[model samples]
Structure formats: structure tokens, C-alpha cells
Target: MPNLQDVILYESKHQEKDFVQPHSHQTHQILYVLDGQGRCQLNEHTSPLKPDSMIVIPPHTEHSILAASKMTVLILEFSHLHVDADTREFLIKPVFKETKVWSLNLFVSSEIRQLLRKMLYEQSQESIEYKLGIKLLLSQLLFILMRTNQSMAQLDSNTLRSSWLKEYIDSNFYQITSIEEMAGKMGISSRYMNQMFTEVYDQTPMRYLTEVRLTRVKKMLTETDLDIVTICFEVGFESLSTFYRVFKKQVGVPPNRYRTTYVGMSDE
Candidate 1:
């Protein structure tokens, strides 16, 4: 049950002659750069503002702006009251943090730019129901921004988890015996770990683990004089027959033959 209050719009053109001294306001500001380039100073940090760059400035945050060239900016300012608890905690709080500037590229699509333009037009009109139209547009825009942010966050988190899992396999391949054990260490189910591995690496977790073991076996075969059984055990293979089968299938040769071929090449 959020209420929007004091909705105002400002479309301004600025050049080298214009300057805004440091200031703050009580209402949240959504500023979009329509054209040209500029620089915004929010407290101690300065960010370059280009066409289609949108910024959300929180309440009572000191900020200033200077035009690097001729610039046109469309700013929407408003305050909200009685926002739902979850929305306030997640979407609103993050954007309104004093130390953070919520910025996104509005020029990612022509549709987005058109939507903002429509909102601006509605805001400028004094016709019947224009206020309602502006409010609806603003709500839609906020929804899009929140959804985009959530999607990007999820992608980043998945990427980080994938990287950590790969590093774990790389470092612990010698001791890892099964996919379940690896997944257990990470406190996730084997099936979910496999799914993550498949999505990120295009292979199942157990398959990737086997690949890691086989890669080490090949390295040992080429670089060291270790016997086939010793190399197999060192690479965490519990069964000689299974190791030989996998090695022949994946490397197209038995372990001894692979070592011999590598040795012959080095000698030649």
C-alpha cells in the first residue's frame, strides 16, 4: 500500500555556463540523461553521465552535476509512504542507500527509451487523468528496473558459485572420490550440483570430476615415469580395470600405450 506524493518533473538543458552547487532534497530523484554528456558528483564520487544513463538518487544525499558538453536531462522526483514491508526492505532500501548510486542503462532497448519518453510526455500534460497515467508509467518503470537488477544479481551469484566449484575440483581432485562427496562439502545435493555444473560447464559434476582425474593421469603419463597402477591410484581411481577402461575410451589408448607414445615423441 504505497502512496506516491509530490511527483514533479524537470526537463532541463545545460551547457558550460550552467552550474549546480552541492545540494540535497527530501524526495527520491530518478534522473535520465536524454542526450549529450555530463558528470554527476554524488558526495565524494563522480560518475560520467552519457545519453540513456539513468541514476536513482536517494533522499537527503548531497549531489551536484556539471555538463561536460551540451546536455539535456529529464528528472522525476517523488516521495512514497506506507510501502509494503518487503518492497521497502529489498527494492527501495538498496536504491536509497547513501553510499550507493543505483545506475542502469536505459538505452538497452528502443522500447525502454520509448517508454521513458511516454512517461515524460504524460508528466508534461495537464490533461484529464494525466497524473494517473504518469503514476502508472512510473510504477511500470520501477518494476522493470527491479526485475532487471534481480536477474543480474542471480546471474552473478551463479557465476561466482560455478567458479568456486571449479576451483575446488582443481585443487582437491586427488582426494575427491565421488560427486556426492564433493557436493556434500558444499552442502548441496549431488543432483543440484550436477545441474549447476551442466549449466555452467556443459557437463555433469561426476563427468567433470572424471575429466579432471583423467587430465592429471595424462599429465603424469607424459611428464613422470610413474607406473600405470601408481598413477591410477594417485589420481584417485580405486579400480585398475575401471581406470584402464575410462582412459582407453577418453584418450583412445590404454595407460601404458599413452605413456609409451608420449615417451617416443619426446625422444624423437
Candidate 2:
């Protein structure tokens, strides 16, 4: 039950040449660079700041940031979170090790970026039980960062490649035409890429891509007024027959009938 105390989270956008005077906080601070370029000085050492860079500054560590180009940073300040001894020993301690600043690869960075966005949204909405929500989200964020740090050493190059491939298909499945095109973009053979991807994710890239597209199609069918033909093409099916056949096979009902049944249930 790790609980954050006195949390303060905000984003600072700086214009070129802008700088923050040296300052220290009584609470631990996490600085995440979202956009642009800068340099962060912690004590006497400095590190370049670019998109996906992260810094964890312990309380009382004097630090400053200088923007070489326009920059956007998310700053999170909080007191030492009360946590179970086991969590503090393993996951928490390693994250704030001697290395105060580092960069995350694209896949891990994307996950962190999404969590940060959700935290920002929660902070903005301030709905009921928002503090609790933020605390849970913070825990999730820390767990992810810790696991990412651990996995960096254990993951092989092929594993990393597979992770990146999965992330790409997840984000761009609707626009992807073929596995060969994706393999070319990654500069790897389709056969090898497919083998590695399947090894890591337990499915071929095309199967994963279809799963992603159909997931979106289901959401649109139930929540939106878009017709089946439009939904099919919108989700990259290329034609209604193919979309309908796959949708019915996977979902066990035609798209229209599924939507009619589910949406009607929701109204009751």
C-alpha cells in the first residue's frame, strides 16, 4: 500500500534560451522531458535533456534546467511514499540509484508517456476519489519504470525488436498493408521478423494486427453511430465482405446484430 503524500504535478514549457535558477525541493522530484531540448544540472553534473529523458532527484539535491531549444517538461514532486518494505527494497530503491538521469527506449517511453498523460488527466479532472486514483496510477508508473529498468539487462536484441514491432502494429494496424512493408521498415527479413515477433508475443504480426483492428471495430460498433460498411473501411478492412466475415467469425455474431444486441441491452 504505497501512498504518495503532498503530490504536486505540473508541466513547464520553456522558450529557447530560458533557464531555471538553481533550486532544491524538500520533496523528491521526477522530471520528464516531453518535447524539445535542454540540459539538466544536478549538483555539479549535467545531462542533456530531450524527449524521453527522465531524471529522479532526491530531496535537497540542488538542480536546474536550461533550455537550448523550446521544451516541454512534466515535473512531479512528492514526499517519500510510505510503502511496504519489500517494494522499497527492490523496485523503489533501484529506480533512484546512483544514476540520477537516463533515457528510455521508445517502447518503454511510450508506456511511461501514456501513464503521465493519464496522471495529468486525473489531476485536471479532480473527480471523486481522484487522490486515490493518482496514488494508484503513481504506483503503476513506478512499477513500470522499475520493471523496465530490470528488463533492459535481461531482454535480448530480438526480444527488443519484437517489442518494438508489437508496439508499431498496435499503434498503426489500421494503416499497415503487409508484413513485408513492416519488415522493410525495420530493415529485417519478413520471415525472421515474423519468427521473432511470434516468439515474443505468441502470435504472428498479421494476427496481432487483425486483433487490434477488430478490437477497435467492436468499440466503434457499440459506442458509435457509424454504419458497418463505414466501420469496416475505417478500421482498414478494405472491403465489407472481408470485414463482415472476420468480425462474425471472431465475435460469433454479425457486426450489426452484435451492436444491436449490446446497445439495446445498454439502453434497458
Candidate 3:
């Protein structure tokens, strides 16, 4: 169960010259743009406002909003301090750490907007249960945000995994030799490996490997006194002729000429 504190709703219209000066609040706020456009400045970061822009401002964080035009915004302010520790931590930390704006248009459903409207309606009521209704709706909204955060965390994990895969490839590129061998070492099919690489890097796995090899080769050619033939085999090219062909094709110069040109530049 969660406890709600200082639960309040505000729907305000701002003219072009009207603005809220930078300030801090004791309770968390969900500021949803209902109409018009503006810019919200939260601490050092600023986000553009439009319809469906929801900004989550953490407790005690300085923020302000200025309208670009006649703008309307709905703000829901509450605290989750009395909630279970995990829920409280989840609600407070990540929302402020990441991008503050959660554009409602990106979600698959419009349930959040509906819930906010329902809460607004409940706030207008004179009945005793209206308070309970507002709390319930607010809780639902927090859970939705939590779920969205979890999904984003999973995406971050996938991105980290992709990064690890690229690093592994970079470290072992000289010995791995082929896409199939690279895939075998990772325990995935080459096709799937290529798919993952392409998704993250926008290039096939083999192309990325080639780029890595080419970069190393370019560095060696520029910095080392090694002969082209030795440099070619050392950088893991099996055929000297194939190396020369690729070097020319990708770099617009053969390896020997590239090395000579680098030396000439260094002498200047």
C-alpha cells in the first residue's frame, strides 16, 4: 500500500508574458500539457512542451515553465514517502535521472490521459469518497510510470549487451577470422549475430570487423616501420593481394603508397 501526501490538482492558462519563476517543491509533480506550447526548465535541463507532454518533477528539484503561446497545463502534486520502500525509490530516482519528459503520444494507449481526466473530475466533486478516488487514480498512474520505466531499463540492458558484443569482437578480431567463427564463439547463428550487429551499428558484423582491421592497419602503416607484407599478415589478412585490393578499395590507396605518404607527411 502507498500513502499519498499533499495531493492537489492545478489547471492553469498562461499568456505569452506569464511564467513561473524557478522554484522547488516538497512533493513530486506530474505536469501534463493539456493544450498550447511552452518550455519547461527543470534544474539545468529544459524540455519543449506540447499537448501530451508529461514532465515528472522530483521533490525539491527547482523548475519553471514559460509559455511560447497561450498555454494550458494540468499539474498533479503528491508524495509517495509512505509507500513501500521499493515503490518509493522507483518513483523518485529514475524519473529525475533520465529524460524528464514522457511524451504520451509514444505510448500504445491513452489510458494515462484518461486517468488524469478522471482524477481531475474527482477533484471537483464535493463527496467524501472523491479524495479516495483521486488517490486510487494517482496510484494507477504511478504504476503505469513504473511499468514504463521497467521497459526502458530492459532496453538499456539490450543496448549494454550489444556494446559488450562489439567490444568482444574488437578484442578478438585478429584471431576470430570469420563471421561464422565469431558467431560460434558467441553461441549464436551468424545470421542472428549479423542482425544484432546491424541493429546497433547499422552495419553487418563482417563489415564492422573489416572496419576494425582497416583502422588498425591504417594506424600501423602510419606509425610503424614494418614492411607492407609483414604488416598485411600481422593485421590478420590471409592474402597479401587481397589486403592490397581491400586497402585500395576502402582507403583509396594501396598499403605501400599509404605508408610512403604517411612517412612523407611526417618528414615535413
Candidate 4:
């Protein structure tokens, strides 16, 4: 959807006192810290950089990074055409129009780390379809960042209730009975909480909880030899029929088939 161009993606490690002089890029630049600490000087403002933190520099913005300790960072630079008008306005324009930096929560940090690593692998391989792979991955990365920004915006007037909701779901997805119940625990109306959560997460609370369960289902299917029905209830699915149906729809295969295929691949 992004149709990104002139892409440059790479990793950098800096020792203490290392500095990157003030510079500007014609393309939007994203710097994500993988380890250690630093400080980013953006125009007249400065922001701290620690592990799992990211800074998004809008096109032509003056910025520099100074490492206060050993640091590893992934840098991605790209420009895009208006091929997807909706993406430009909703995802790219709003999120990247200004220099912004934020620390990622554990769930988002893990996901973004995996995506960035895949992009690095694609860049290194330079395979025939690497360009396409990079474009898709970059688009996904941007979408995740956009949702994260939306969640942060929800708490700008108060506290990060959306983040709290996500963390709670991540930790207790298997035991979560209903969104209304969860909302009640948070001292909010189910309707209101669902609206706020969906606005920030781009999905309803139930959908997010389902996704978390499915992610666990996938891992257990590949890594363990548990029976499908057992795994289903373990992951908190109430009905075998529903589990099979939803697993097939979301994963494109039934649980047994997925396990079989993955096991065969691992053996090979």
C-alpha cells in the first residue's frame, strides 16, 4: 500500500561519544534502537533513546544521534508515491509529518523487532523479489507504527488506558471471557471502552484477544505434540467447532494440517 521508493535500510552500532552530525534526508527516516542508549537531537528538541525506542524523522528534518553508551540501531529511509491515497493520508502523513520518538511496549517491541530483522535479511539477500518483500514489510511496519501512535494519542489527555488494555489482553488472553467483563474491570462501560480500544488498535477487543490466542495456538502447534482439542481448550477456545473454523479462516489451514506441515518442514 505504501509503494515506498529509494529505500535504504541498515543497522548501525555506536560506542560512547559516537556522534552522527546533523543531517537531513529527502525521505522519511526511522531509527529504532535495538540496544543500549542514546539521545536524539531533533531541530531544537531532544529525546532520550533506549532499547525498543524509535524516532521518526520527517523528510528534510534536521536530526542527529549521540550514543551515551554502546548502541545498536536499525535505520530505514524511504519515500513513497501517492499510489495509495488512503495510506498516504492515514498512515504516512499523520505519523511521519513531524519528528517524533516513542518507546514501544513489549508486545509491539517484539513484533517490530521481528519485522525489522526480516527487512535486514531481505536487504542482505538481495534476492530477485527482495524489493517487493521490503515494500510489503515496510508498509506493515508503518501500519503498526500508525496504530501505536493512535493508541498514544488516546492517552494524551489522560493516562495510557489503551496500552493497559493491550498489556492485559496479552497477559491474560486465555482467561478473558468477554470484552464487557474486561471493561468492567477497568471501570468503564463496555461500549465506551470498545470504541476507544478499536480506535487505537484498529481492531475490537475480542478480535485482539482472538489473535493472541491464535498466536499461542500456532506456537504450540508447531513446537509441541499436544492433541488439537486439548490445545484448543488450553488456549481458551470454548468449542472445538469454533476453534477449527476460526483457525482455518485465520491461518488458512486446520490445526492438525498446520502442525503436520510445520513438522514436516522442520524435519526436512
* TM-scores of the candidates in the order shown: 0.76, 0.54, 0.60, 0.58
List model 1 lDDT by residue over 110-209, tens digit each. Answer: 5556767887788678888887787666666666766766765776776778788999988888788887898888888888877777788898767877
lDDT of 4 at 101: 88
Residue pairs in clash, model 3: none
Give the lDDT of residue 195 in candidate 4.
81
Cα deviation of 243, candidate 1, in Å? 3.1
User: For residue 69, what is the lDDT in candidate 1?
Assistant: 87
Q: How many clashes in candidate 1?
A: 0
Error of 2 at 29 (Å): 1.4
* Model with the higher TM-score, candidate 1 or 3: 1
Give the range where candidate 4 is weakest over 10 consecutive residues by summed lDDT. 1-10
In candidate 3, how many Å is residue 184 off?
8.9
Better of 1 and 4 by lDDT: 4
Model 4 per-residue lDDT at 253 = 90
- Where model 3 places Cα greater than 4 Å from the true spot, the runs are 1-4, 81-99, 160-268
Question: Model 2 over residues 172-249: C-alpha lDDT tens digits?
Answer: 887888889999999999998888888788989988889999999888888889888888888788778888899888
Per-residue lDDT tens digits for candidate 4, residues 196-251, read 78877888888999999999998888888889989999988989999999999999
- Candidate 3 residue-wise lDDT, 167-222, digit = tens: 98688777767778877877879887777777778998788777888998988888
Give each prediction's root-mean-square deviation over alpha carbons: 4.4, 16.6, 7.1, 16.2
Using TM-score as the measure, which candidate wins? Answer: 1
**Residue 16 shift from truth in candidate 1, angstroms:** 7.3
TM-score result, candidate 2: 0.54
Clashing pairs in 4: none
Instruction: Tally clashing residue pairs in candidate 3.
Output: 0
